[model samples]
Target: MSEAISYIWLGVLAVFEAPALFSLAGIGIPAPLVMLLCGLLTGIAVGATPGLAGPMAMAVSLPILISVFGVSADALLPVFAFLIGIMKGATVGGAVPAILFNTPGTPDAFMTTLDGHPMTLRGTPERALKIAHFSSVSGDTVSDIVLFVCAPFLAVMVESVLDLPEKTALIILSLSFIAAVMGASVAKGLISVSLGMVSAYVATGQGFHPRLTMGVEALSDGFPLIAAVLGVLILGEVFKSIFDMWRGIRRKRAEDHNADLAPDGLRPGDIRRILPHIGRSSLIGCMVGALPGVGSTLAATLGHSLGKRRHETRKGPTDKSFGEGIPEGIAATEAANSAVSGANLIPVLSLGIPGNAAAVFLILAADSIGGFNPGPSVFNFAAPEINPELVVAFGIFTLMALGNLLNWTIGGIFMRSMGVMARVPNRILLPVVLLVTLTAIYVQETSLAALWVAIGFGVLGFFFRVLEISVLPFVIAFILAGSLENTARQAFSASGGDPFFLFRSPVACGMLAAAVILVVLLARKK
Candidate 1:
């Protein structure tokens, strides 16, 4: 236990002892902390605006951040902290648009719009925004604590027994779980997952020769990872927004030029009334987020539905229920969604599987940066010497806590004042985002082929969105394809080319069977 505490202490000091971004009054300030603040503010602004989101900002900033930071081991903490801050801040800022202008910033925030806009209409916009910020930050803090406690313990336990075959089965299980629980139709989610696996396998896998490449020199090297990801996530979003606007599916983002209502605040009674909803929603969100591809949208929906049910039961159907501008409604939705930010990291940090888009970027950061490898091995406490990856893991935890601190202190004020950002026309924002994204890709790859790959994937993403298919399964599957293939191949080799190698281990066989059962059950239910 002392050893563990010693490592944790080192991790905490590592962040404070890092190279300073600047010196103030002869005291050096850490770069990671500064970047966290900067990213948090930027994320809040982005979330306040319509047609922008945390993942979009993350996709655009990643390549540019890499270029500036140079992918050094020391750069990892600062770079990842900023992304973490953006994710945390966006959860709070997303409520701004949903409350003040009746515009949900992201799909999950649609739950917020139910009671949020009603609050604004009833002349309690300030109170609505404050409720969102407080609940978001509180839920985020709870989830972060869960992450800090759970990830290392789970990683260590998994490391003790998992072999190549077991790991292979686990990856298959994760993909299956993601496909089964992700979208409206289990079939559509499976299709998305299949497409991603196919895309990821092109021109890359185990073996001396690249099997999928069509003899083109550029294809031989395969698609640029960053470009493909950004194209699908960022460029695809841009193209879809433009297409929607052109097709009249989306109206121009005209501000509701209504009178500024009097400011309101959350009284003690209000806090007392909303606390239970926030607590329950936070628990619900954490549970959902621990499973890969079960996104915050579902969490928000479940939180709101259950909160409403409980509220109705208590009020005897006569009191002001949910969707009637009650603070509990805002508390339920915001807390549930925001809690997903930290709990989503559980898979990324412990299992090396990304549960969401934010986790995807974090895994990408670890891969691109090198040095720090995430997985069960990362938490190896019996190492004869210090484990650097373990230190980095705890440093990430520290940064996350700092982000929550910022959210608690100044987030409400900033979010309340961000009502004007909702009016910044998407017409002006979309083109700038497009150009910057393209530039960031080129600067990273320094190749025209990368640009073309991004455009191609972006088109594919546009269609996927149009078809109402979930992108989470696709993105998660694409990222995991290589890991699955490598583990399977190694297992096969170890079994002396036995095709039934994965079944040799009872645990692995049971896991694989469970995966199949999950698919069948979900498909039938859907």
Candidate 2:
């Protein structure tokens, strides 16, 4: 216990003295602190704007950060600190659009739109925003604390029990779960997963020459993952919004929509009233987020649904129901989604598997910057020389704490201000977002080929959206396929290419069976 407490104190000291330890790019300033501040401000601003999100911000900043920091062991902490700030900031920021304009900047905020916009229509936008801020920060803070406490233990356990075949089977199970539950139709989800697997296979020289590049020299490097993600998710949304605006669909009204409400700060009584809802929704988010392949959208949906059920069961059918300008609705959705931001890191930290889009970006950043990798190795301890990845993880937690503080102090103000900004013409907002997105992609890749790839994926994504196909499965599959292939190949190679190796291990067999059962259950549910 003393040793653990000592390590905790050491981590705290390291966070405060980070500037002294990391000297980045010959800059005298404390890079982590400055980057954290920049990330928070940028995340909030971009998240408030429709069609922009935290992953987009991370994608844009990643290459710029790598270019500036020069990809060394020292650069890891500063770079990851910025990402943590953005991850926390964007969750709080997304509520601004959802509450004021019924526009969810990210998929996780979709549930917020149901009740949030109604509150805005009721002229209580401030109150709705406050509920969102309080619940979001509270859930995010608690989830981060859970992550800090649980990740190392889980990683240790996995390392002790899981071998190569079991790990490979686990990955397969995760892929199955994602395909089963992510999309509207199982057939569509399978098709999307196939597309991702095919895309990932392109230019991948896994005991075979690169295929699918069409003999183009630019394709030799394989598709840029960050560019592809930004194009499909961010630029695609920008393109859709532009087309919608041009067609006079989903356009903002020209008249100002700000409401003149009294000071809408939450009182102690109000906090006490909503604390139970926040706790319940946060627990839901944490559990879902901890499961690999399940995501924030589902968490938010489930949280809102459960909260609504609870409200109806408790009320005498006379109280104002959920989604009827009630604070509980905002609390449920915001808390769940915000909690997901932190708990999503659990899988990434323990298993080296990214659970969501934002986590994929984090893994990419860690890969791009050398000297760090996620997984059980990150939690390994060596005497005298601290585990660098573990130290960086602690630093990330510190930055997250700072971001939560920022949200608690000023997030409500940002949310309140969104009433005015939400009225900005999509014509102007979307085009700028598009230009900035493309420009960022260009700067990062430094090639016209990358631009073309982004444009291609953007068009594909637009059509997918139009067809009501979910992109989550596709994105998750794309990110997971490379690791999946590598792990499977490694497992096979270790077993002398024995095809039945997976069935030999009880753990692997059980996991595969569970996956099969889960798929059947989900398909039946659908």
Candidate 3:
């Protein structure tokens, strides 16, 4: 224990001296700190904008960051610090618009609008935003602590017990769970996952022929990950908002702009009353966040519903319900979603699997920069030489801590400022967001083909939303498809193409069985 503490202190000291070691753009300050601040500010602004999200910000910043940092091991620390900051900051900032204008910046924030906007309507927007900030920070802090403690143990356990077939089965099981929980109907979710698999298979095969591309030269290299994700989540949402704004403008239904900022007069008694609810929701979010593909939206929804149940039961079923300007509603929703931001890293760090859309971008960034890969290997305790990736992961945790501090110290002011900003007309704001997203994709890919692909996916995504089909399954499937194919092929080659080899492992068989059962149950319920 003493040796471990010394090593951690050494790592911290080394990080403090990293600028000297790496020559960080001739700046005296450490690059990680600089990037963390930049990402935090950028995330808050982006999240305050109704049509943008954390992954969108990540997709846009990643290429630019790699260009600036020059893609070395030294670059990884700063880059990841920035990504971590954005992840934390966006969760906090997303609540601002949700409270003030009923315009959630991301899908996870959609639940916040239910009670948060009511608070705004009741002239308590400041109090609502304050509740969001405090609860979000509390939840995020706890989730990060859980991730720090649990990731290593879980990774070691998986590394010891799971073989290739077991890993593949686990992925399949994760996909099944995601499909079961994400959409209104399990069939639609499965269909979306199938489409994503098809998309992933297109032009990405290692076979003699480029499969599923139909000889299209532009698709020979397959879809760009950043562009595809940005298109689906960011541009798709932007296009829908644009259409909505146009309709609203046609109907002369412009939002009533409010620029006055109210003070949040939260009492100590109020904070004490909400602490139990925050702790409960944070734990719920942390558990869900650790699972692959079960995202902040579900966490927030569950938290809100559970908190409502508790509130009603306590009130003897006669008092006003949660949606009518209550701090408990904001606490529940914000706590869960913010908690998701930290615990989502558990799957990414321990299993090399993205739990949500934002983790997908982080994995992509790591892959593009090419120093580290996430997996159980990352947590391996190889004694001779240290695992640098683990150190970097710890460093990211530190940066996340800094982000939370920023939230606690200055977040209320920032939230109030965004309340004013949220009143900006969407017609004007969304166009700029759309332009930036397209420009980001163009910058990263440097091909008009990528832009066309993004546009196509944007259209597809908009339709998916309109049809109430969940996009989470599709996105998760697309991101995991490459890893799945590679792992399965490796396992097959080892088994000399014996398809029955997967059944040889009890773990693998059990996971497959679980997947089948989950699918059957979900389908029956649907």
Top model by lDDT, which number? Answer: 1
**Where does the lowest 10-residue lDDT sum fall in candidate 2?**
251-260
| Pairs clashing within candidate 3 | none
lDDT of 2 by residue, 299-341 (tens): 8998999999988888775777886667888899889988888
Candidate 3: 10-residue stretch with minimal lDDT: 251-260
Could you estimate the TM-score for every candidate? 0.96, 0.90, 0.91
Off by over 4 Å in 2: 1-10, 20-29, 206-208, 251-264, 316-318, 382-384
Candidate 1 Cα errors over 4 Å, as ranges: 206-208, 251-263, 316-318
Tens digits of per-residue lDDT, candidate 1, 1-526, equal: 8878988888889889989999999999998998888889888988899888888788777777787788888889889888988898788899999888888868889889888888787778888888888898988999999999999998988888888999999999999999999877888889999999988998896577876787777788777778888888888888999887788785333233344355577766888889999999999999998888898999999999999999988985567889877899999998999888899999888999999998988888888889888788888888999999999998999999998999889877887888899998887888888888888889778888899999999998889888978777888888999899989989999999998999999989999999999999999998
TM-score of 3: 0.91
Q: What's the residue-level lDDT of 391 in candidate 2? A: 72
Candidate ordering by lDDT (highest first): 1, 3, 2
Q: What is the lDDT of every predicted structure here? A: 0.87, 0.79, 0.81
* C-alpha-based local distance difference test score of model 2: 0.79
> What is the lDDT for 190 in model 1?
90
User: How many Å off is the CA of 168 in candidate 1?
Assistant: 0.2
